[model samples]
Target: MLNFERLQILQKYYDYIQKKTGVRDYFLVGGALRDILLGIKEKLDDVDLTIAGEPIGLYAQMEKEAFSHFITEKFGTITLIPKEGVMQGIKYEITPFREESGYQDVRHPDDIRWTNSLLADAKRRDFRINAMYYRFLNIKKPVYEEKKVLDSTTLLKVLDREGFVFLENSGVLIVQNSSLIDQLLQNGQMDSDFLYYLLDIQHFAYCYGEEGEKTDSDGRFDLQIVIDPEYGIHSLINRKLETVGDPDIRFQEDALRLLRGLRFVNVINQKLLNNENKEQNADPLNKVRLFDFETETWKSIKKNHDLLKTIAKERIYQEIVKSFSEGNPFGLVALVDEAEMLPILFPALAKTKGYDQPIRYHPFDIYAHIILTLWHLQQINSNYLVRFAMLYHDVGKVGQYEQYGLNLTREEIRNILAGPLNHRFSSAELMKEDFRNLGFSNKEIEEIKRYINEHHTPGEILMGNSQNWTKRLRKLFSEVGYEKLQNLLDINIADRLGMYNPLQNSSDLTDSYYLKTLVDEIEQTEGQFKKSDLAITGADVMEHFDLKPGKLIGELLQVGFDWVLGDVKHRNVKKQILANIANYLKQKK
Candidate 1:
């Protein structure tokens, strides 16, 4: 529980309620106490406060205060999230203290009875870690520290001192009673939603606190504690952090537990070498494989873009927008395993080569390379959400539409392996349709679409460059849009990593690492056409030469763009560019 932020917001809201309607002793139950001990923070976007013995007008005060971007009401409990910034839409729900009876749904109690006891309200939470509570008289001013351990420092130290403290390390404070966990697991309670999400859907489980609550025995007060890995809370915090705080909540929450899995793995490998620990952690666990971004895009396509159908387009758009602006997309793509999603992503290709890569060039062979690329991607930046644009980019290669392959023997043979020239183009269209489905706004789709199309354009430019690396990069940036230049490199990296021969037209260029020399060499110097150093734009060339902004001007820009890429000094006046274009066009003219 990140009690400070959680309670602070609740306290502020309660104080506000007191000021407006004179509501006192409002009950703040669930997750608030858990977050405080778990080293988490609260979001002021929406404040949820469970009013004691009342199910009305929780928002009379909020309606009077900073409520521009918000809408308020009381169905049973009051929910208010600050309607400022991206988090403006996030909701903070305040419910009246209530005891639940009879399970009509998997996670919700069918009947509700308003209660005055703190334990009754807290018992409704899914896990023990999420079931703690604190109550205050009003929201205007709060005594936050009372009976509340409001920071992670105290609990973290103790948990760290106790190694193999898996439950504590989870950052969720578990209650001693087991009944809460058991009840939530049963159908008809709202907790079943979380149970299904973590257990059936995601296949992860809660590390329940082993002890029991001595004071409250029907297990009504008992709760299991575990970190909420779902992005909702993180997303809520992420939307608000930009306004006043840093964006990383996990770092402040409990960085120890944040990378605990990675840390454990590292220690295991180290100790296995030195035999430091008595019991060996390894038991020859089979390596798991997942889809790379490209493969997942194909699978998503087969699923008919069903993933983001439930979330708002704006939310998806914002995430995509942030991904492009703040994160590494290629690396994110590497996490997706195309193999697992074959039938869905590129059923067309899966039937032909069986979605297999040409093994002679790849070490892990085709299936393994996809997984390898995702692994390599994880080693880089794990923060950014890779775009579906890039994810669907190479999916066309997976499906082997018999008609696509070109063979001299017969039309049937040619049709056997090669696809139409528009294979990737069709894939792009599918991607565009799913852009919003994948959580992108329409405005974001345009940029992403261009990025996808042009990802391969740079490789084509390099091929046409007669082996000019610097020229290739310049052409890539200018023509493709310079924003995702590094993204292009990441895509190239994934492509090379997933193949035996990603470079040459033939199998001759099989070794993936061999390109490191060339790629590094490209990185060591400047790219071909940096925006600051550019000699001329299409408009400039057309206006200067008294030329129409037609095919002629287009040709001139391409020629001039290439020229400037080869020589940095061409970034000067338009005279040299016009002169060169004159001569080049005169010869063709």
Candidate 2:
């Protein structure tokens, strides 16, 4: 018996479609099939169906049933959503069997032709493992319980003479359909050789074809059923799965697949390592090997790495985000570097690879330091903004010595090298286009820039004496805001931990205690630190000094705000402020 519980949704939808349009050539394809075969029990929110006939006919039938659907005539696909039933709210994407022609842009098909052959459609998919399909047959009894309703028995219905067949685990079962079998055999649609060939089990040599079948008195044959064990003999077989066509041609057809291939390599390596940890003596033969591409594929990618530049920035950004979101982002990035795509995708990161830092402060070069910082962020489970900040934090250090020259005075060098003013600002300025091109929202890009610009301020404040530290801390907090201050501290801590030295272990660059105390003090203190917080406004200044709304009012407020920053008591001295404004105006005249 088939796994009826696992096949209920497919069966229900198949039956519904067949009842409506009398179409029986639909099959469950794509990731749903791959996930089912992998025994991954995660809840899948979408179902993809490939039908051998016109989907628009099914679309018209579904419309009569009042089912909502979206049609795309360009690709011959329709997304149907049932209004009521066990599969309510679920979206099923139904597409007619079609083949793609040219991909001169490396992203889209230049021409699409409808086909009636399932095999032809399967051959056009990206990978062998994702190319399988599952066909389900309708039966008389209730196949499985519907979890969404209380009365499951009400769903059962008797079938007519049309008959039904269910395909499961890459094998098809015809239920009470001997005539359909004979029809398939005569029409060259469902012969045993074709079935076994589709299942990749022909090597077992269990023939169910016309040559070796036992015929009943009515001339119907009973074929021997061949099932692969759970830990099947196929696991022992080694097969190299190339792309459907030439690997170079595939990459040229879609350059994004190059990055996808690298991601797969890292993902496969991680899975292998996890499996190795679970079973110390696991057979090496049981592991799925990485896809070994032809040498020409690598050559084509290296030659056409710039083709990635031609792809939509949003698409490239999505691939980059997926790479970083994986368990092994560092490894994946290393692979990107190996493929020479990093320079094209992230020229900022590429420039940092060999740039050296002062040995006393940094143990690794600029690129390694950034990677180490990212590793720290990963350890803390930091969000993407913090991780991205760490990635570009020190990229501005490249060519700094040559740009600024080596003969600068200590104070001048410090001013130029300060995070907020020079390197951080420069890096943020340089990355604006890169970040925007990578599909980051304007708000996200600004926030990242804020983090990079202020990453060093927290440490600077923490290392200061308490005398002026509050003022500095308040300024930093006001500039970066409360939410971003936390992120800035995270980047600071990661950057400090990433530095190389004997004392690195002892450093608390984030200075959580001190920063927290500063936060608490700022919260408790009611005095003005900003011009807007001054007790006297620009209107007060203009009225008291007998001046209209002009530059003089703003100048007077700045002087008062400066005094307030140095001593909060200055905010209450209205008469003294008026006297100071007069003197300041006298000096200006």
Candidate 3:
């Protein structure tokens, strides 16, 4: 059942819509419903509803009331964002009851047949666990008493089954079975002549976890719910992942479902593992196991994995972002490799599977090293760009190793490390094309490339003394600002933890901490790493040096900027910068 606070908010919208269109047969469906049953309350800020008629007319009416809406006419869907009211910041998407067929392009339906049957809509969903629905029932207003009525044997039975909510503030008791209310009235359990006359209490029942056929002789359950037609609640309890119908037909209709199915498994399995220790005391013998793909689902994925090529790169990138945002990217990456989807999704990265590195430094092959890096990175940072940088950080080494062969002398490998600029540049160039195909903006591509370039800087600084570190660190700070440097440090730490180098030790991490301290100190004393940090600006240089508004003024400002970075104390002394630039111009003689 939905919580009282969110349910109350949803009730307001339901009342608003019912007053306008007189449509009472609608459902809260899809992921919002699935998550609520999983004991996940934080992600229920959005709601998805499937109504019994065309959504365009209702959307048009909502537009008149000044609610912003985006519609897809082909699918009869509308995403409505409320600009004002008690439901502000909550997103609501409404789709008319419809069935789909003839997916020629493997994504959209070639024809959508609108219907009043909720079962048809449930059958068209991708996964069984996502097919359940939640809807309220129509019942006479419940009689309210000043004394406690929660102890009524009839109401207690419904509440024990976990499908009812009692709104304490409004004195409205909501139950799924109207039959239970009849019993309450007959037993004279309430203090009123009639059920409390609460008009807004209509949206209160949670009709889920049962079959449509199992209802009262009056067929009241059939009227309010088509819950679990695919046995979704059963599968959810066992931690299973299976397609709603035929796996092959579903995957062929939309190949992106292949990856999405795996992402679901990965995320749900992570949640199950996290809850295992907590659940041990509650039921030691019946602890829930992690999720596994149903047998047919696994077989279908292997057969149709190649169909991913037909999907758009931008769409694929969106799925990747969603998986990474869930905080267990390594699990998803590993599952992608196990399913053989890695070769189709990232051919270059797949080629690194058996590529060897210097055994003295790396214990795993390039592919295993990359995977381990992602695992370690989760402990330090969850930024997608930081993770991506570590993924491709050593991809260029595949080509380098091929050129040198596996028999290179240790001295030759040592020389490669001394100047790894070539491989870093090569890796960044390769990442550029991948990012462009994934629809990243030009600015985002450049920022990620800069991170790739500086990935090795932290380890290099770890080898230097504090005096040399200050000079190099300040130069880097001036170039990339503080946040990017912090991200680079995170990548460096994960990379080290992924390796088995004898040259690196616990002291390396100790040095990393010192470097972080220095970064904070530099930022606190020098302020932002921009021209504003300099005591003199372009105008000041032009005025004090008698220079015109041209390139010379900009160059003289850089001179002052560099002087301040040399010693932050110089920033507070304008005369020192003027004298420094004066000496710099004299040197131009």
Cα lDDT of model 3 by residue, 233-336, tens digit: 55665567899899999999999999999888877666655556556476767566677888999999989999988888888888877777663788888888
Which clashing pairs does model 3 show?
A: 142-195, 142-196, 143-195, 143-196
Candidate 3 ranges with C-alpha deviation above 4 Å: 1-22, 56-66, 138-226, 271-289, 406-421, 506-508, 538-559, 581-589
Give the number of colliding residue pairs in candidate 1: 64
Candidate 2, residue 60: lDDT: 69
> Of the pair 1 and 2, which is ahead by lDDT?
2
**lDDT of every model, 2 decimals:** 0.41, 0.59, 0.68
Per-residue accuracy of model 1 over 66-159 as CA lDDT, tens digit each: 3333333323755554445444555556676677655432223457777654445544443223343443321111111222231334434433
Model 2 root-mean-square deviation: 10.6
Ranking by TM-score: 3, 2, 1
On TM-score, the leading prediction is 3
Judge candidate 1 at residue 146 and give its lDDT: 20
Worst 10 residues of 1 by lDDT: 238-247
lDDT of 2: 0.59
Per-candidate TM-score against the hidden true structure: 0.52, 0.67, 0.78
**Candidate 1 regions with alpha-carbon error over 4 angstroms:** 1-48, 53-55, 61-63, 66-92, 97-131, 134-354, 363-368, 382-390, 404-426, 455-467, 480-483, 500-550
